[model samples]
Target: MKKTLGIIGGMGPEASEVFYLKLTQATKAEKDQDHLNILLWSHADIPDRTASIEAGKTEELWAIMAKDVQMLKDCGCDYLAVPCNTSHVFQDRFNTMMGGHFISMIDEAAACAKTVGTTIGVLGTDGTRMNDLYGKALRRNGCTCVYPDKEDQEGVMHIIYDQIKKGQRGDLSLFLNICSHMKAKGCDAVILACTELSVLKNNYAELSDPWYLDAMDALVKTCVTTCGGIYQGNL
Candidate 1:
């Protein structure tokens, strides 16, 4: 039996699109309806996760995302997923709204990172960093989380929110530099906790000895499993 996949998206419109496309390819169904049943709410008006985190605007952001989740629930979605890593800020809020069983990219990524090794570096927006969503999940799974320096994290935020999420892609040198530093810091792996990092994966041939974990890839894999789809990714 096939299940419907409801997406709480538009945190960054590009990641929402990427999630849809990846889910389609993963499902491998010929026709549109044959593909995974997806209900997407691409509400670009949702407040920025980075800004909300840095400026302590959590209530405003979650309120917007909560409405989206409720709409998906009202639409009769069987399960809910948010493609944005930072939007997981509202996990607790969504849990309270949806009864506490939402599929989480943070947990999925943490489990995947454990398979790769125990110590990992996290690259995400300010909200994700400040809130320690990924870091907390990693700790729960017997993994240690290393963070980029303050300036490096700021750089990552700019690249993701200011650049890639807006569909402008260039200047990956800073990201590469961070990867090198993580590897040097003895990280066994690194989780790209921001879904927008999906656009930056092809720039290098494996930046370091430490494995690279893409949170978007983890979400796609979850979708594949829930919808009986085929997933092809080495992360």
Candidate 2:
């Protein structure tokens, strides 16, 4: 029996759409029915994760996400995927609420990074950086995680919010410059830990450099595998 995959998305709607498209493109489907069953809840109204985290008031945020989890469960989803990286800071709470049905995007990315190299760079929002979501997971899997310097990190935020999230084409030069900075810091690979960055991965052809592992891609692969579907590779 094939399982159903649930998505708790719309932390930003664009990233959620990317995740869905990747799933469709990755599945080895010759017919419509061959694709895996998916239940998506695109709730764009969830409070800003970075702002909530920075303010030290995540209780309301947690409540909103927990409600989403319950809705997925009620909808008969077998496993859950959240596209937003910063939202994984509530993994423990989600585990408790969902009883281990959540599939972690960070864990999947860390596993992939472990195969490629020992040192990796992480690029994401202030909330994801301050929480060390990728850093802790990669380190636990025996890899060293590097972060952008203060200036570059701010630039990362600008690329995600000011450009990609606003539906503008991101500055490829800015994105590559940060990747080059990570390479200069001795990182063998970089994880695009933000879903908004994942949007960049889908939209920009320039990201084909192979040095970046996108969190959304990781989640798509996991969703396919968990639902007992074969991944035909990115389309």
Candidate 3:
């Protein structure tokens, strides 16, 4: 029997769907039965995480996520995953609210990094940076996390918010520019801590060096593994 995957999405509608499509593509099974069962609540009404963090609306956002988690649990989802990086900020409380079995994007990303080295760079929203969410987790596991300065965080956030979230393929020039900056700062690899970064794989080659890690890819990998298969990257 296959386990049903529950997703709490619509932080931006497109990114949530991207995870589903990637998961289906990642499955190794040749037939429909081979693919993992999936159940998702693409609740676009959930308050925005970034907005709450920036505008002091955390209560509103957390309330919405808490309610969404309950909705998924009520739907009988065996295991749950949240694709958004910043949303993990409320994970602990949300886990309690949702009744646990939550798949963590940050924890998985950190484990992937720890296997290769001692330090890595994280690129994501101002909220993600301000909290050093992924960075702190990596450090707990003996991995150091390097984040961009305030201005750089703002730059990356703008690209994610203004461009990618709005459904525009982010300008590769700007993405590469950030990559180059991270490389210059001695980061061995870059973790696209934001799910919105999925748009970059459209143009960039993985072999372009300075290993580009996608958190969404790691999440998909985790989903496949949890559902009983090894996921080969569609990139």
Candidate 4:
């Protein structure tokens, strides 16, 4: 029997769409009935993850997310997943509060990063960096987490905010340049730690250069398998 899966989405709508698409892509189903049960709560007004994290006002985040979880449970979801990476800063507390139903994207990404390299480069939003979300977990897994330098990081943010999130084509050269800089700095692989950056993998073919691993893809795999669906490995 497949367990119902619930998603706490809409931290950024595009990313959540990608998460849903990839979930279907990752599931090895011959027909519609073969797929796992999934419920997505994409509340349009869900608080901005970065803003709340930066302001250190995570209680509001907990309130909104917890309400969504309860709503999903009322609808019969057995396990929950939050596709947003920065949201994992509350994984520990939320797991404790919510009875450990949430599947963690950060831990899944860190595990994927471990398999990819001993020194991994991470690209994500400022809130994730501020909380050391991926960094701490990667370190715990014995992998060195490498981040972009100040200027390169700002460029990455521009691509995330001014480009993908806004439905524009991010500068391909700029993104590759950041990957090159990380590689030159000794990163065996780079993790696309932001969901918006994961959106880039569809636009830029070079993003599939084997030098990159998408955190969103990692979550899709874990979520699929955990929900009793066979992983299709399509990502």
Candidate 5:
């Protein structure tokens, strides 16, 4: 039997939608009722995660996220996940407060990367990048971490916020250039640490695997297996 899943989302509404659709695609189901019961709070009004981290509004972000957790709890979910990678800077605190399991997409991504290569490159928002969130996690998993240079970092932010978040197809070359930079730097594998980038990955079937891993897909597989459901993996 599959346990109920809770999604604390809306860090960017587009990312939340991608997460749900992928979750559905990743699940093994024969009937409409076979899907895990998911309680999604796609609250678009929550403070922007990157902005909150940059502006020192951690408390405001936490308070609002806490309400989302409580609301999910009220819905009786057994496992919880937040689709936004940038928002995971507070994952440790959330794990403590969660009534059940709070799956860490960051950790899952790192683990997935470790299996793919010895040196991994991560791409995410400034909040996540500056904090070295994936860096710490990837190191712990016994993989070396590589990151985009300053100009490439700005390009990453642009693809996420200026394009994908705006529901635009986001400049593919912008992302590919960042990837090329990582590969040039000896990155054997690259993680799309941002959910918005996962959107790009989903749209572009040409992005080869093992060379690239989607953190959102890791979350989907983990959520499925952790909740006692079979995963129909696309990874």
Candidate 6:
């Protein structure tokens, strides 16, 4: 039987949309019924995750997410995927709160990276960087993780918030520069740890330098596999 995939999304609405689209693109469906069942709760009004974490107060954010998880469960979702990277810091708590229905995008991404190489570069928000969500998970799977310098990390934030999240076409040059820096640092591949950064995959076909493993893409694959569907590969 096919399982229903629940998405606790809208950390930034654009990223969630991309994730949903990826899920559709990744599935090998010849008919509408062949596609996996997806239930997306795009609560765009939820508090900013990075801001709450930086402020040292995650309780409100956790409460909102936990409530959403319960709602998805009540709606008959069999499995869950969260598109946001910073939100993965609350995976353990949310799992417990939701009685373990939550799927860890961080873990999925780490597992994917493990198959590719042992050394990876991470690109995301300040909260994701400070939390080391990707680093710790990848390390557990025997992969070493590297990150861009402070200045470059700021550039990443600018692209995510100032550009992508705001619905502007982000400057690909900024991303290329950071990927180049990570390559110079001996990273085998770079993980687009932030869902907001996942939007860059659209421009990836144009460049061939830094190989990227997108977290949202990993989550889409996980959703398909968990739902007993085959991933049709990247579009």
lDDT of 4 by residue, 1-235 (tens): 8999988888688889989999988899989978889999887587778889888888988888778778988898888888888888878865765578778888888888887679999999988988888889999999999999999999998999899888886889999999889999999898898889988887778777767889888889988998999998844
For candidate 4, give the lDDT of residue 231.
96
- Candidate topping lDDT: 2
As for lDDT, the candidate ahead, 3 or 4, is: 4
- Over 1-83, each residue of candidate 3 has an lDDT whose tens digit, in order, gives 56677898886788888888889888887777788878878888876787789898888888778777777778887788998
TM-score of each: 0.90, 0.97, 0.92, 0.95, 0.96, 0.95
Ranked by lDDT, top first: 2, 5, 4, 6, 3, 1
CA lDDT for candidate 1: 0.79
The CA lDDT of each predicted structure is: 0.79, 0.88, 0.80, 0.86, 0.87, 0.85
Clashes of each: 0, 0, 0, 0, 0, 0
The true-structure Cα RMSD of candidate 5 reads 1.2
Residue pairs with clashing backbones, model 1: none
Q: What would you estimate as the lDDT of candidate 6?
A: 0.85
Residue 225 lDDT (model 4)? 92
- The parts of candidate 5 lying over 4 Å away from their true place are none
Worst 10 residues of 1 by lDDT: 201-210
Show model 6 residue runs off by greater than 4 Å.
Answer: 207-210
What tens-digit string does per-residue lDDT give for candidate 6 at 24-77?
Answer: 889998999989988989999998889999998888888888889889889998
lDDT at 78, model 2? 86
Residue 89 in candidate 6, Cα distance off native in Å: 0.9
Q: What C-alpha lDDT, on a 0 to 100 scale, does residue 39 get in candidate 1?
A: 88
Question: Ten consecutive residues with minimal summed lDDT in candidate 6?
Answer: 201-210
